[model samples]
Target: MATIREIRRRIRSIQSTAKITRAMEMIAASKMRRAQERDIASRPYADLMRQVLAGLAAQRQGDDDIHPLLVQRPVNRIILIHITPDRGLCGGLNANVNRMAVSFVLEQSVPVTIVAVGRKGRDFMVRYGREVRAEFTHLGDRPSVVDILPIARVVTDDYSAGLADGVYLCYAEFVTTMTQRPVIWRLLPVEPATIEARLEVGYIYEPSAASVLAELLPRFVEMQLYHAILESIASEQSARMVAMRAATDNANELIEDLT
Candidate 1:
């Protein structure tokens, strides 16, 4: 058993840690509000893009005119767009994502290139000396589309150029203030079911169907990357907030027990 003085000393250390965590929690909470707002605002555009793609796909199905984005090819080289936090103290958010990535790599028998976004992913990849093709960071406080555009372009270009057979994104999808689930989402060969689901609602396409699809396809892919970045950042903050809150609460409980 530890003495009261020892307990007090431990408590003091925990208090200091709690202070940092609390600050991080406050910061994460503030950013979460902005992120959630941006996500909500972008929903309409995503919906619209999906609808337009579905309509175009339907129109072209009769002619057997398929876009390059809709074709499935022989699997060989794959690229993973990994999203993690720039900073630490966010619990196992990064670790969980990395675990899923490891599983992804294990399940498939092909060469993989990683486009690691954020410090956590980059740092983790460096240890294994894996092929991390690109890295983006310093965007956690407030990530913008422009911040992620280069990486998105590279991945899309690789797929289009046949450098990579498929592209997948690993991210933590934001559920609520306290819950985030790691997920792997397909980025290339856009899922037909997604288009079909969106097409259930009627939408009028501007210009010709082929023309609209030609434009929307690329943008849709870019937006998927952008949206994943936003979701991951938001999820990071929420996880930090919840983790810090738990630490703070535990500290208070210890103090109560001591008194």
Candidate 2:
């Protein structure tokens, strides 16, 4: 057992930690609210974009009429865009994403490249000796779509240039304040099954159909990347808020027991 003076010092240290955790909890909560709202509000537009892309696929003809974005190819070289927090203190958020990403890489038969969207993801992959083709970090509490363009461009350009056969995104999906699930979403060679429900017929294009798709397909991809980043950030803040709240409570309990 510690002496009275030692116990008192320990209590003071815990109290200070509790104070910091509480502040972080409140800050994360505030940002989580905004991030969550933005994530939700953007869903409708995202859904519409998917619908349009599906409709374009429905318009597919012979090899000449198909858009390259919708063209399916064998998966040999793969790229995963992993999203995580720039900072720590969010319990298992980065760990969970990194685990899933590494699991994915391990399961693949060919070379896998990672496009890291935050410091944690980049650092983790680098430490494991995996290739990181592109990386973005220090995006702050909130980041706009413009900030995500380079990330989107890097992967899309690689896919277009045939440097990669498949593209994926790994991130945590915000289900609720206390629940976030890590998932892998394929971004390239768009899955027909996912958008089949939204497919429709009989739509005339203003310019040539191919011309219209050339303009819209890239934007569609960029939007999806932006949405993923937003979701990841929101989930990070939510997880951080919950973790901090728990830490504060645990500190309080410890202080009480010591007394």
Candidate 3:
């Protein structure tokens, strides 16, 4: 059994840890608010872009020309786009995402190549994934498309080149401060339904609908990825903030009991 001195030492260690966590929590909380505002602010532009793309896609169905991204390819090899935190200490955020990604891999029959976007995802896929094609790391806080563009382009390029038949992006979709759910979103061979829902507006194409789609499709994919990264960063901050607050509360409770 540990003596009172040892217990005191342990408490002091945890106290120090709690202090650090509390500071981190405050920093993350401030960043989270900013991220939330940015996300909300960007929604209108994103939605409008989606609507425009959808209309373009719908109009192209009747035309002879169609964008390559909309063309369905035979199932052969697959690309799994995985996203996770660069650091730890935020409950099971990374673990749960990893679990879902693993489950997805296990269910797949075709050969898969992983394109990991974070250290946690990269490490987990390296250990577990059947095949890891590429790994990216060191994505700092407050990421942008420029940071994630190269990775996204690689995945899309492989799909376009017939190297990968399809692409599935996996990430933790933030639902609430207390809830984040793992999601496997299809990225390649863009879903028609997804386009149809937003094609409410009509437009007159300058060159052609197909030409417009060809240019817009890749940008859409890249922007979507950027959005996901921003969301995950915000979710990480929120989760960390909550976790730290709990730790501080527990420490306070222990101090009260001791006194």
Best candidate (score: TM-score): 2
Candidate 3 clashing pairs, residues 3+ apart or interchain: none
Question: What TM-score should be assigned to candidate 3?
Answer: 0.90
lDDT of 3 by residue, 35-125 (tens): 7776787677777778888777766675556566777868988899898888897788899989999999889899888988889998988
Error (Å) of candidate 3 at residue 97 is 0.1
By the lDDT metric, which is better: model 2 or model 3? 2
TM-score of 1: 0.87
Estimate the overall C-alpha local distance difference test score of candidate 1.
0.83
**Model 2 pairs in collision:** none
Provide the RMSD of all predictions against the true structure, rounded to 1 decimal: 2.9, 2.0, 2.3
Sort the predicted structures by lDDT, highest score first: 2, 1, 3
The window of 10 residues in a row where model 2 has the poorest summed lDDT is: 192-201
Query: Whole-model Cα lDDT per candidate?
Result: 0.83, 0.86, 0.81
Cα deviation in Å at residue 163, candidate 1? 0.8
Model 3 residue 235 distance off true place after TM-score fit, in angstroms:
1.8
- Model 1 agreement with the true structure over 86-193: per-residue lDDT tens digits: 887788888999889878877888998989888888888888777998888787566677777798788878887889989999999999887899999789978666
